[model samples]
Target: MAHTIQGKKQLLTRVRRIKGQAEGLERALNAETECLAILQQIAAIRGAVNGLMAEVLEGHIRTHLGAHDISETQRDNDMEAVVAALRSYLK
Candidate 1:
């Protein structure tokens, strides 16, 4: 999407951070870290992922659905796409 392209760097940084968190979680698992610590790490990773998703989703909404210049058909299509994506993500 255009918005994603515009924010590509920021999104990539988030993805890299998430990757680092995943690697840390792996290391913790291998090292047999305490259960509470592991849980906290997992929660942190999940929160990071959710934040990334929210950012992208917001961009999509603003760029596609919220644009006043777009045609009605285009807006409907974008809305459907967003709904489908949200449904899949929720599942």
Candidate 2:
């Protein structure tokens, strides 16, 4: 979470852009925009979200699992936690 705190601003910027994209999609639906353009908007939003997830997941792995200061038990727990989260997210 410390890594996330350090990258808070950058992460928020990405989240804001995703929010904007969602709003744009909503507007397109309300306006009855063409199907292709609406689909493109949805795809952009999905890509942005996936990018955000990947960045945060990488940070978590490096900080929690890769840190040498932590004990083996702690690292195992952290690895399991990461795996569980990935399973949930993928589902």
Candidate 3:
């Protein structure tokens, strides 16, 4: 995908925050945090990551699937990829 300034900025911010959250989780583990607290943090990180994935998939649908230039086959492939990702993520 071609990089637009806005897309790049948004993705970079999301990825950086996810990285920070992952590091915080590691620190919590290393510090022997309470099981409940650690699990809560892990769950929060997972939600954040999933939300980011959804946002990217939405953009893919709009930019690629909705584009007039793309063929029907390509659009179907994109939708299939999104559905496969959603199923995997939901599992």
* Candidate 1 lDDT, 18-61, residue by residue in tens: 99999999999999999999999999999999999999999999
User: What TM-score against the true fold does each predicted structure earn?
Assistant: 0.94, 0.96, 0.82
Query: What is the model-wide C-alpha lDDT for candidate 2?
Result: 0.96
| Ranked by TM-score, top first | 2, 1, 3
Candidate 2: stretches off by over 4 Å:
none
Per-residue lDDT, model 2, residue 1, is 90
Of 1 and 2, the candidate ranking higher by lDDT: 1
Q: What ranking emerges by lDDT with the best candidate at the front?
A: 1, 2, 3
lDDT of 3 by residue, 1-91 (tens): 6533458888888889989999998999999999998999899889889878877877777787788998889889988987898899889
lDDT of each: 0.97, 0.96, 0.84
Output the number of the lDDT-best candidate: 1
TM-score of structure candidate 2: 0.96
What's model 1's overall lDDT? 0.97
